[model samples]
Target: MSLAPRIVLVHRTTEYEELVARHGTHGQAAFFLASRGRDIEEVAERSRRTRRALDEIAAGIPLTWRQARVERADLDRFLFAPEDVVVVVGQDGLVANVAKYLAGQPVVGIDTDPGRNPGVLVRHRAADAGALIASAVSRAGAVDELTMVEAVADDTQRLLALNEIYLGAAGHQTVRYRLGRDDDRGAVEPQASSGVLVGTGTGASGWLRSVWQERGGGLVLPGATEERLVWFVREAWPSPVTGTSLVAGHLSVGARLQLTVESDRLIAFGDGMEGDAVELVWGQTVRVGVAGVRLRLVG
Candidate 1:
């Protein structure tokens, strides 16, 4: 028998959560914030709005639909079925956060604080959930196929990210590796720097753009739907055995930038989630490129 599509609601803990976590109670949190010359009401108000939106969204789901809620911290442990309609109930970053774990699920982004948060990813209001849910089930929704980046370690471990994948030291310290392509010049030069970042077009709008701006805007960043990849090496120092020639560049679809570990330890992580990462030891090679899977996000 066939299975019905499940509705997966994704959210992240708010600032109010951390406030109460440290202060024990909302009243105590308020007092602590007030003592620091800050108003806790603002934080509480935002948290209230987020919770209200989540409730409204949940209420709109059909009773027959199998639904589940997964927090941002629990995404790593949660398993998503193929027939799942993901509804991200938070800011823009939450959508990007859930994108890595998903294969091709349709993500509906709901924004709690429209004025405070950028609605680039979470572009819809809670009231639109009913129609959006119907559209997604019928495959009639406006879905954007966003490109993603992937890194594969020599040991067969892999990582995916909607924004970017970073390979470097755990502390963001100087990374030692050989940067090059697979053709004639397999591994070009040994580099020691902050690390390397392999990003997609979606990433270009954020961190990649900042790095491009810092480098005088030479790299050609692709669009959100483009099947392209761009790379950048941070603070690559010059030495007798090292070179900075492969500082920044772009990769066409299916092409990969190879990096062999020269340091005792290096970590590969996606979308800034350093805690859940792939570890690479000396002499290990990691190839980063555009992933075949794309994020099917409802616009």
Candidate 2:
């Protein structure tokens, strides 16, 4: 007989908890919120709801299965096995954050407040977590294999993104880089732009959508499950040293985007988490392509 699968619960800090941690006390947090005309009771109520949801989900996990709980902030340090079933109980972004850390593990996204926060990723309700967990463990659940984007530097430092990867300067300054692709070798052009955004089909409605809309919607983006990626250059500037012709394009299988850094420093980040990024200096080459792994999101 096979052993029970380990269920890992993932969550994020509540607004009330963050306030208290920053202010050092509940009373101080309340006062700080009041000064900004925000009600502390509302924040407290949200925290209560989150705790209730967490408790209900925990109670539903089978006692026979091994269980573990982790916060989003500590996901990097958390060791996840291939057979683990990850249950994320938070907003949609929490699901995206956890997806990168996983290889092919099944993930169940539980929305704490479904009514207010309708999400594409966090589709399951807290009340249904028990059934979902059981289904996932038995490998009988409906799974959505979502495409992911990956960025690899010259040093072999790789980062996976569920939504998109942003590459540019650390600040709001214009970034200088030589952009090219695997298909077009000698056609590489020097670009000075705000940044470059490499996104997947799952990210079409996110930052990619905004940039696409701004450009008057010329390109047709891929679907959430499509094995393709879209890239857009934000505010590409045309100068004597830089060209803006290669602003946006699509990347299919066997096609990869390459960037040779000409700036003093360029930062690459995934899922809009700028703080957690990889730094690339001058002469470094980074490749963006469709990731080999896909997110097995339980539907």
Q: What digit string (tens of lDDT, one per residue) describes model 2 on residues 28-68?
A: 99999999999899889888889999999999988889999
What's the lDDT for candidate 2? 0.92
Candidate 2, residue 59: lDDT: 91
27: Cα error in model 2, Å: 2.2
lDDT of 1: 0.90
**RMSD in angstroms, all models?**
1.2, 1.1
Stretches of candidate 1 above 4 Å error? 184-187
lDDT (Cα, 0-100) at 29 in candidate 1: 95
lDDT tens digits by residue: candidate 1, 1-299: 77766999999889999899998999999999999999999999999999999899888888977889999999999999988999999888888899988988899989889987768788899999879978988899789999999999889999999999988999999978999976526558888999998898888878888888999998789998999889999999999988898899888887889999999999999887889999999999999998989999898
Over 4 Å off in model 2, which ranges? none
Q: For each candidate, give its TM-score against the true structure.
A: 0.97, 0.97
